[model samples]
Target: MKCIMDDLTVYTPSPPAGQNALVVFPQARECPELPPSGYAPLRGSAPLGRVMLRDGRSAWAVTGHALARELLSDPRLSRDRSHPGFLAPEEWSAEVGTHGASPALVADPGDEAPHRPPLPYLTPRRTAALRPHLQRIADRLLTGMERQGPPADLVSAFALPMSALAIGTLLGVPYEDHDFFEGCSGRLLRGRTVREAATARAELERYTGQLLDRKRHEPGDGLLDDLMRQDGQGSLDRARLVTLPGTLLARGHETTADLVALAAFTLLRHPEHLAVLRAGKTPMTAVAEELLRCLATPNGILRVAVEDVEIAGRTIRSGECVVFVTALINRDATVFAEPETLDWDRPAGHHLAFGSGVHECLGRNLVRAQLEIALGSLFTRFPGLRLAVPAEEIRSKPANPTSDGLLELPVAW
Candidate 1:
C-alpha cells in the first residue's frame, strides 16, 4: 500500500531545552528515554522525526500529550485493520502474524466489511456463567497459597497458577493441559521471531480446537459451552473458536497476573497505601482504581489509523500505526497532580487502564474483582510481607515490547 505524504502537515518545534535536554522525534526509535519522573511533557518544540518501520513504511509518532489524546479518540483514526491501504509495522506483523483465515477479523477498520466476531472467553454472558467456577478456582488458589507458605515467588506461585486455573476453567481446559497451554501462550507473547510466534499460535489453535470438541459432546457450564449455544451472535466458528482460547490465554491471564504481582509489589513499596487498604479506610473500589493506575505493566496500548485526521495540530494520515502511550497518559501532569508520587488517598476518577471507548478491555470488571480479592486477602492475611531480594536486583522486563512484568519477585512475610 502506498501512503501519500506530500500533503502531510509538518510540526515545527520552538527551540532546544537546556544543553542536557533530549531531542524528541517522530521516529519511535528516536523516542527520548522516559525519565522516572511520572510527568514528562512532550518536547513539542522539537522537530517531528520520521519513523521508518521495519516493513519499510514511514509514519509520524507524536509525543505531545495533547496530540496523543486527540489522535487516540479521533473518529478518522481507526483501530480496524481492514482499511484499503492498511499495513502493519514489520516488527508487529512479524510478532502478531498474518491473519489469513480470519482476514476480515484482522482487516483495517476502514475495510468495507469488518468482522467483529464475539469471543467466548471475554463476553459478558460467558463471564456470568463462569463466575461460580471462577469463585471455586479462586478458593482453591487461596487454599494452595495458605498451604505452601510464603517466602515464595508470587509470579510462579499464586499469580501464574491462579491465572491458569481461572482461564483454564473458563475455557474447560483440563488441568493436565495447563503446562502446554501456558508454554504456548508465553511463547506467543514473548517470541520476537516470526517463526516461533507462528508455531506457538498454530499449537494454541490445535489445543483450543480439541478442548472445544470435548466440551461439545459433554457440555459443561463453562464459558466455551455457553458460547457454543449462541449460534446467531456472529459466534466464533470452528477455526475462530480454536484461535479464541489463545487470545484469552494471553489476554485473560498474563496481564492480570502481572497486575496482581505488581499491585502487591507497589503496595509493599508504599506501606502507607498498603495500610490504607488494609485498615478498611479506603473502600475496595478505591483500592481497585488506584491499583489499576499504579500496577499497570508498561507495554501500553497499540492502535492503527484508518483515515487521515488532525490532532493537536499534527496530521496523522491513514494506514499509519499509533502507539497510545497509556503509561505516559496516566501520569500526565495536566491530568494527575504530583504525578510522580504514589498517593493512595488521591481522589479516584477516570483512568485509561482498561482503555477507553469501544475496544476497552472486556474482562476489566473481572480483573478488578480478582485484584481486589487477591490483594485485600493477601495483605490482610500477611501484613508483614516484604521483598526478599534487593529492589534493584529484582529481575524485570523493563523494556518488554508486550508487557511490564517481573520474572521472579521473591517476597517474605
Candidate 2:
C-alpha cells in the first residue's frame, strides 16, 4: 500500500507475487529485551503509518510524539468500542470488538461506559486523604517480604499482593476475595480467547454486583460506599454503579502490580540507580517518575475516527481505526533526551506514560503514591537486593506486546 508523506508517495511493501501478503504488526518476540518492533522503522516515516492487525484488519499506527498527543486529545477520535471498525486488541476476536467496552489491562478515562458514574474519589484530594492508609499497606507488604527473606518472586510476593491489598481496600472489596478476583481479572485482561475473557468478565460483574447490593444496605468506608452514597443521593444509578466496580477491580490491581515488578527489575539491572535510592540522594517520587517513563509499558490504545480528520498531514476517513503507539511515543527522542537511557536525575516533563488530555489515567496519583512508598520501603529494607536470575533468562507474558511484566522476577538479597 502507498502512504503519502509530505506530498511524496511512499510504498509500504505488499505481498510477494501470487499469495496474499500481510503487513504484520510489530512483535517483540526476538527483541524481548526491548520494546516492540514496527516502531523503529516508522521513526523516519510519516507520523501516522499502517500496520495489519492479527485479525487481518488494517489500522493506522500513530508513532510521533506530537501527533500522538494531538490525536489522543481530539474529540473526533472516539474510544467508544461500539463504533464501526473499532479495533480490539490482537488477542480478542472480532466478535469482542463488536460488543461493549473492550477488555483493558490498563484503564483510561475514555473507556468508561456512558452509563457509569464518574469516579470522583480518584481525584488528587481523595488520593491524598488515603495516603496514610496506603502507607500502612505498603509497609505491611514490605514487612512480609523482609520476613520471608530473598530468592523470592517479587511479582507474587510483593507486587501483586501489595497492589491487590491497596486497591481492594480502597474499593471496599474484602481482602479475602482478592485471590479470586485476581484469578478472574487475569483471565479477563490477559486471556488469549474472547470466550475466556467474556466468561471472566461475566463472573467478575456478578461478584461485584452482589457486593454492590450489600453495600447499599450496609455502607462501608471505601470508594464503593461513596458510589453507593451517590446513588442514594440520585447522582448515580444502581445499574451503572453495579458495572463500575468491575472496571475498577479489573484494572486497579493488574497494571500497578506490573509497574512495581517492572520498576524493581529495571533498578536491579541498573545497580547504580539502586545505589542512588539507597543513598537517598534524590526524592523517591522524582525517581519514580523517571522509572515510570523508562518502564511505561502501554503498547497502544484503540480509537476510531468518528469524523473525517486530518492528522500529521494524513487524512483519516471516519470509522477507520487508529492506534496511538504510546510505548513508542513515550520514547520519542524529541521529548526525552537519550530516550532509551534511564536517567534518574534527568529533568523530565509531563509524559504520556499515564496518557494525556481528558482521558488521562485516573489513578495517576494513587499509582505514584504506590510506587514511591513501595520502591522506597522495599530497597530500604533490602539494601542487598539483586536479581536471582540473569536478566535475559527472565520471561514475560507474551500474550500482549504491551506487557512490561516478568512472569516471575526472582530476587535474592
Top lDDT hit: 2
lDDT of 2 by residue, 276-364 (tens): 88888998878888877766666566788999997667899999888776666767778888877777778755667777877777878
Model 2, TM vs. native? 0.83
True-structure RMSD, every candidate: 8.4, 5.9
The digit string of per-residue lDDT tens for model 1 on 193-258 reads 556666887888887777877877887765667677674366456765666665565566667777
Candidate 2 residues lying further than 4 Å off, grouped into runs, are 1-23, 29-33, 90-110, 174-210, 213-218, 399-402
On TM-score, the leading prediction is 2
Model 2, clash count? 0
Scanning candidate 2 in windows of ten residues, the lowest lDDT window is: 1-10
Residue 194's C-alpha lDDT in candidate 1?
Answer: 56
Give the worst 10-residue stretch by lDDT in candidate 1: 25-34
